[model samples]
Target chain A: MTIAEQVGAPRIVPGRGIPYPCGDPNLPPAAERQWRRQLVQRALDAVAVAVEHPTIFEVDDVNA
Target chain B: MRIVHYVNQFYAGLGGEDSAGIGARVLKGTVGPGRLLAQLLGAEHDIVATLVCGDDHAASHTTAAPELLKMAQAAGADLLVAGPAFGSGRYGLACARLAAVAQAAGLPALAAMHPDNPGISEAGDAPVIAAGATAREMRPSVQRLAAAVTKLAAGEALTAADGRVIQAARVGQLVEQRAAARAVELVLRRLGGDREATEVPVGGFGVVDPAAPVDKAASVTVALVTEGAVVPAGNPDRLESARASRWLRYPVEGADTLASGAWESVDGGFATTAANADPNRLLPLDAARALEREGAIGRLHGEFLTTVGNGTPVATARRFGVEWAAQLRKAGVQAAILTAT
Candidate 1:
């Protein structure tokens, strides 16, 4: 996350980790896919919004 | 002090660009600009031998440096000097390489070139005296080289104040306080309204103005790019698992999702077991494709670009970004989703 900020990524959405950025292996296949869908959707929404600087778009903020 | 000088064929009075294919050879002494340089260094410095190499030959061959250094050592050289190559790219690079080899061989060395020369990056801590853009500034360039040599021969440290190009490397210095104590002091200073109390200064990466927001996500072609090292099964293009010098693109025109057996993550920075089991976790191709179908996006780009980011230099990453962005723009890609690991 700090790496993204340091590199000045304009619209940042936090990822799970290095191994599974979109999906969680701990979840069931269906749940994993659903979680991935949400994460990816958040990324899509991030691109649609304009940002003045490197801004983090939290999943909670997106959900709200 | 006995000095051995390195110069390109042109500077050695051995013809012009047509002679660039000629291999390395040694001239007896004081070829072309070496005479001016010798005069600038005064009577104490003797340019014992002049090593002349064709730019084309020097740029392509790595074996030349050690051989040339041997010749210099045989000539009883106390110092190795390479061009004030000025704006010439190949010559500057050759000079920089020679300086590096000389330093490793325990022969003190100095190179002169324009600071913006691409060779500056290859210089590796060797002193590079700032020169003008072309030979038109030869006098000043030689003067700077002479001044640097005088100090070096006397066992003096060359600093930026001496007109030596400071390399983009960190110099270690012993500090009186421990790291934890320093950190606490810095924080306390900052809390006490010292806004600029930073021990480490962040730089190098330049600010990029954010691109305008996608006016309509449902009508733009979005491409997926990744540093997750997702490549075709068997790693067909052989995208490096670490410090990737290049990026590869795989066709996904007819594919709905990245199947487990069809693609895998080979990034060396992290364990790939999870990503290999489900490549889409790193690329999110399945999710992206679904989003396209659901009208969240207009369409998916036919191919996705991938490269390993593990331990890759920032400059290389920036170059890849620029090239990819140009290619994407040419393909009418309005935006890109770059996934990183």
Candidate 2:
């Protein structure tokens, strides 16, 4: 994320971690897929929104 | 010290631009500027051999450096000096390539060229003495090369004061004061209106105008891209485990999800156990397919581009991004989801 900020990626969507960026294996299979879906949805939404600078599109902010 | 000098056809007195296609060959002793360099080094160094190749040939032939270095090593040359190439792009590139090859072979090597030569980037960690833009500055350039050669042969570090081009690699050096003291002093100086008193200068990434928001998301084709190093089971393209120099694309057409046994993450920076257990964790192809089916996006671009980003240089990454963006644009991709690890 710091690298993303430093490089000034115009649309940035924060991911989970270095190991599994999208899906959380700890979650139940169905819930995990739903979580992954929301993450992808957030990324999609990020591309649809215009920003003046490197802006972080938080996954949890999807509902907010 | 025994030296092997490299020069292009023009410098070798072979011919002008007409001789540009001449191949690599060796002459027993000093040729052209090598004579001046020899005189500069005085009685201590011997110009054992001169390796001459046409600029066109050197730029095009991959085998030239190794073949020439072999002859140099056979001649028992201890140091390799290539070019006061000045502003000749191809010659400078050849010189830089030779320096890289010589250094890799455990030979002390140095090159002299104009600082703006495109070859400087390919010189690796080899010492490059800054030269002027043309042959008119040959005398000083060779003199600088001679001094640099003496230092390198004696296992001494060349400093910026020696007119060495600033190499891309950051080298650690011991300073008079500790880092904390230096930091505090810099802060105090800045607070006192010395705005330029920075220990390290930061270069900007340059401003990039943001692409306009997708007017109709559901009508656009979105592509998946990753620096996560996801590839087929055996990594058929042999994608590097780290510091990848290239990127490869794989077709995800008609695939609903990436199967664990069929795909894996080869990135060396992180533990791949989780990603290997579920390849989609790195690529999220399954989620993308679901979105496509749901009409959340008009289409998922048929292929996903992958490359290992672990320890990759920013310049290399930028190049990959530029090339991938071009390819995506050509494929009619409206937007992309780039997953980084």
Candidate 3:
């Protein structure tokens, strides 16, 4: 559970942390870029759907 | 261009929490993050002075705005850039207060602070570039604010699309449609037992508890306000096509009515031809005047506030109401009739 879950944020895009929540710093730079892009895209898509209740999106692929 | 920078004690390379009580002081050149803003501003703009003040001192009632503005003027500054104050509540308030003072002194200022900061809500009409919750987002915040400052110096209208400045509210682009046509369609759909969308959110079920009913409608002064962007034909103030931050007050002091061609609608979201040809359509002052003549109301406020309702966010709408209501209250207008398009 994320802070969004803890606080019951009406909407949440799960990639979170103090730093590098979505992408691991130890990962190869190229892989990190891919990981961050997909995470951001999910956040964008999540904004389009209006939700009265808390919802968290999981981004795996760019199109996901 | 001479640019005056502002920072708190810590960013001024002074002591941290211990230095929170320091009085206002002016440094010769860019300190701390002003260097970064300078790099973004390039060599064309001089980071002429960095005015430092303690967060507590700046936030408290000690009064330093006049002197700080005098310092900026003495430096011959063309613009003032204050901190991207992040989530520091006091620091954000300080930057916002300084921004307002600079604007009053004929210098455009830009600052940044997180949306979560209480200062942002109290920032008045001062435009703040969005910042993150901590210094970790400092670079991006500075970059955005510098970009906003550059655009502002060039006298450009920076809207929500610009990605730099954050308006109090954020509204998305909407397709144009007549209210009558949409309403008919919604009615038909609902009759067919299908869910229908609404033009305005009526979560309160389109029901509003009326204000304590005026005891004597004929005795109260009433004010007219509109979000229809109706104004004198020249469009002098150049309010944004969207995401507007300010409103214009058109004095209706003696005029009994608005004549066609004397006023026009500049709202970008809707068809303005009709509203322009007949300004009273968006702002029903003519009708109100008739009501006043019929002894329905005692007086009509001299001036009315007008702003663009097109694509305005709820927060920004609330902001406009707060400011406009204060002005109306000060004028002793006991009642108001607000219209929106």
Candidate 4:
């Protein structure tokens, strides 16, 4: 959301996913950093916003 | 040649939650995912800097977005990239927002995300989202999206993300109904109805009891004029073409000051100045305070809400309003009536 606000970009806030935001603090440094980087990068690419059902942890094909 | 990368606390080398308390920083190049993205680009792109901030800090500061604009301007990055943010909602939303900000500023924005990531749809066409999921997938995703960016930078056309970026069609540009309209007479003929209209214009059908009369001695009615005429005659709010608008809210101040219309226009003809210069900007604050003083309302909300609505997608605009309303509620605001100029 900060990124959106920073760019004065428009975005929809989804209901609670992670307050600290991406990458659980409990993980080891290297793994945690990698996870954090990926999530942040993916977010940078998002041009739209939306919510979801289970909210997190989903599986399936790319086109699905 | 330069690119600015935005990342969450953890990616900025700020430790996780426990360390996430750390401050924000700007770096020279790819730290973690930045490195991967650089590699993915090969020799095609040059990422000059990375700006990392605690998600909380970015989320709380009203001035943060403006601060980011300054940072991007200072960096002079031709391209801006945010996170791919697989499933983290806030981070993902942040990425999408930054992309819009950059795009609004006339820079191409690129980000990656899982197909199911919800922020992609909510952000409303600010970033060029590439396919893939999970951090382990960064290399390829960045590579692909960056390729698209290069193509764009070169003034070359490229195939779209297929369906990755959830794009909204322009208003009045029939989306779901894409087929051309049938002949006017043929369509009107089909719409012709033989039966009389059955519905009433109003919905309230319950009987009304006798109206309670107000005592002349006890009743008082207060009228407040918060004529917040924030306009940039030509609606300069629309900073760019419909697709890439880096919105900059130039204030419309001073109700007494006379101005001429030039930058843009809406249905009304009032001239628009940069939001920072407009005298009408004071109208809301002035009115809110006066209303509060008169006991018409308990308190005035701090800082009038502002945004450049030109070329803004309906979904994102609605989201912004809802989010703003929620925040106002937390601050004890119960109701608000917005007047758009």
Candidate 5:
């Protein structure tokens, strides 16, 4: 959750990566891309929504 | 694109914290991450020079930002790249602040730092990429920061992950959720059976500049407000013992002080027995009235406001303040003495 108070923009949940890893290393190459894609899409949605209260947006993983 | 680069003494191979007291110096070519940044930027951009400075000098002394801007101006730089400062507090603060300094000079600029870095607060829309907590992750961080620079060169919007610094907001929370459930969906879903949403995103908290010091404290009506949850016996307003989102006002008109038997503290976070025995301990209605009697102040607002400050989320707390401030303004409260436990 990057509560973008710094930029004064919408908050962002970049799924799970450290300073720069965008996707899970445990996942296969293709699966990692999928997870990463989902995170990006959710981040877009998180910004699109109008939220007054600080919120936690959940990003989906690949379908089980 | 001509680019002006800023790197710390350690990254420029000068020394670590031991050399942090040194002054700023400019070198003609790329050093350290500048080399990698140049590669990421390719032949299209020129690394005019890398300005190296000690983090201590940059953060403690005021000359750092101006020196960087002067170098940029001298080099005719079209862009500025400042730090992927990782978790180094002073270095991070310097990075963000210097980028702001450059931006104010009319140069396009961006910086990178560990998300938790205090410098993020200084990264006011100048664009900041969230970097890893340690330089061990520099390879990826450099890549991300380069990507942000690329966006700047192309004049594109930067995303939070790309280059947005979350100023004044606590970054991320972990909650339970499948990777498959990216958006709002209660239906069961899973991505490789993963679970946990660790980041809780917070919205911008409105900042209220301090009301100019009351022209005269003695001439203005002052109200006493407490967030330690002091209230009348049995908690008539039913304020939550924890994470309270509401405030209550109790009138003190006519009475010199709040009576202990009639009013008591009910904060679950604290043993109220002490305050219950002396309600004035937290509210100080008696002392406040004493001042009123002495004309030490014009008048005390009839009612004081209170809520439990413990564990309240920033959003809830913000709403409580915005709503209450409006009420206080309407009631003509020129100033307030706020006490929080």
Candidate 6:
């Protein structure tokens, strides 16, 4: 299990799967903005309440 | 050379969540993970021993440090290394605290944590910390840490290590740069005075003679100066976090002294008098009168600069002092004696 998973992380926002782990390298800026916004919203939601155990989801799945 | 390494229970070969409750341990010969580091060094270095403690044990017990020290001494280690603990909050704090203690005791220390970890900044610059995260992913990070340690142990000068970013070594030692010292000396020499302008330090600002020195028969101004302690009762400003605070300037009207036992110091590191009895209440009318009688100052300014001074960051404190002095200049304040109690 990953650390976030092992420690019962409240939320997880997938990066571009690169070592740098920030934004998508190929995506346009507007799409990247949307991705960042979605990720931030997830983080805010998690902190609004106390959570136990890991909760993982796709922040910006281009396919989705 | 002997080296000591610290890690949370999980990374110290204890199992996952279930085993985290394990207490501290001192591995005499070699611990499992120290092998990884020792191998990475490839004869460039050796791992004398490993000092492992559970995260909870380090946090819950403030005495966890002495335990680590005892292990380090027993190991005959010359250097100390704590986890590149990633973003693990408790573990990161433990590593940073232990690293600081070791550094203070005249040992070179290193720690590792992700950039986002709070411990990265809190660790200061004394114990060099390279970037690190999970215990499972220890190859490249351990290699980098070993290289830095190896250089130090070999007495070879090091330019910042591969993963560890340079932070100007902010350990509070103000090393005087030769060029800057010479430049200041040259300037002082240009402005001729009997003073040996090169070595003498600069003094704080004093008020210009505004109304001229008054005769002993006339009223004199006794200014009771303060270092911006104008927070309301209970220090509503909350300006006293031990690490960071800024000063503020406040105005006081004619008052000889604050009423006895009227004000109390909250977050201030300095002592305080009742708001009423305090003579150092900025613009203290009563204190000003007393000063006038004592001929300390000719006149008191209407308003006083207010700012938090308790353990303020050096850069912030310097800026505040400049701004406060500028404000006083604008207000035409004459010479004043700053009082602290």
TM-scores for all candidates: the values are 0.54, 0.55, 0.44, 0.42, 0.44, 0.44
True contacts kept of each: 0.74, 0.75, 0.00, 0.00, 0.00, 0.00
Summarize candidate 4's per-residue lDDT along A1-64 as a digit string, tens digits. Answer: 3422333323222211221223234555455444433432232222122322112222121221
| Per-model DockQ against the true two-chain complex | 0.57, 0.54, 0.01, 0.01, 0.01, 0.01
Regions more than 4 Å wrong, model 1: A60-64, B1-203
Model 6 C-alpha lDDT per residue in residues B73-161, reported as the tens digit of each score: 77777888887677565677668767777777777777777654544544544445465556556776677777777776787655564
Any runs in candidate 2 off by more than 4 Å, and if so which? A1-3, A60-64, B1-204
Report, for all candidates in order, the number of backbone clashes. Answer: 0, 0, 0, 56, 23, 29
- For residues B149-191, could you state the per-residue lDDT of candidate 5 as single tens digits? 8888998988775746645645577768765675545223334
Which digits, one per residue and each the tens of the lDDT, describe model 1 over residues B1-341?
99999999999999886687678788898999899989888888899999988876676566767777787888889999999899776788789888988888889998999886666666776789899989999998898888999999999999887789986668899999999999999999999999987878754765667988898778899999999999998998888989988898888986888999999988999999999999999998898898898999899999999899898876567646655665576567888888888
Candidate 3 has what TM-score?
Answer: 0.44
The C-alpha stretches of model 3 lying farther than 4 A from their native spots are A1-64, B164-341
Q: What is the lDDT of residue B312 in candidate 1?
A: 85
- In model 4, where do residues sit more than 4 Å from their true spots? A1-64, B19-24, B115-118, B121-125, B157-159, B162-164, B168-341
Residue-by-residue lDDT tens digits, candidate 6, A1-64: 6543543334444444321122243556466444444443333233333334455555545435
Q: Best-fitting candidate, measured by DockQ? A: 1
In the range B1-341, model 3's lDDT, one tens digit per residue, is 88999999899999886677677889998899999999998977889999988776676532766677778788888888878889776787778878877876678776788765545665545577787879998898888878887888888976665454564355777768777888898998888887646666532111112334355557777787777787888888886757777788888877866777888778888666656655765665665665667776678788888898777765556545545644565567766655555
- State the lDDT of candidate 4 residue by residue for B82-150, as single tens digits: 776765544565566667667777777666666545445544345556656677776677677667666
lDDT of 2 by residue, B88-111 (tens): 767887898899899898998988
Lowest lDDT 10-residue stretch of candidate 1 chain B = B318-327
By TM-score, the best candidate is: 2
**Candidate 3 Cα lDDT to native:** 0.69
* Residue pairs in collision within model 1: none
| Per-candidate alpha-carbon RMSD to the true structure | 9.8, 9.8, 21.5, 20.1, 21.5, 23.9
Alpha carbon lDDT of each predicted model:
0.84, 0.85, 0.69, 0.47, 0.70, 0.54
Selected candidate, larger TM-score, 1 vs 2: 2
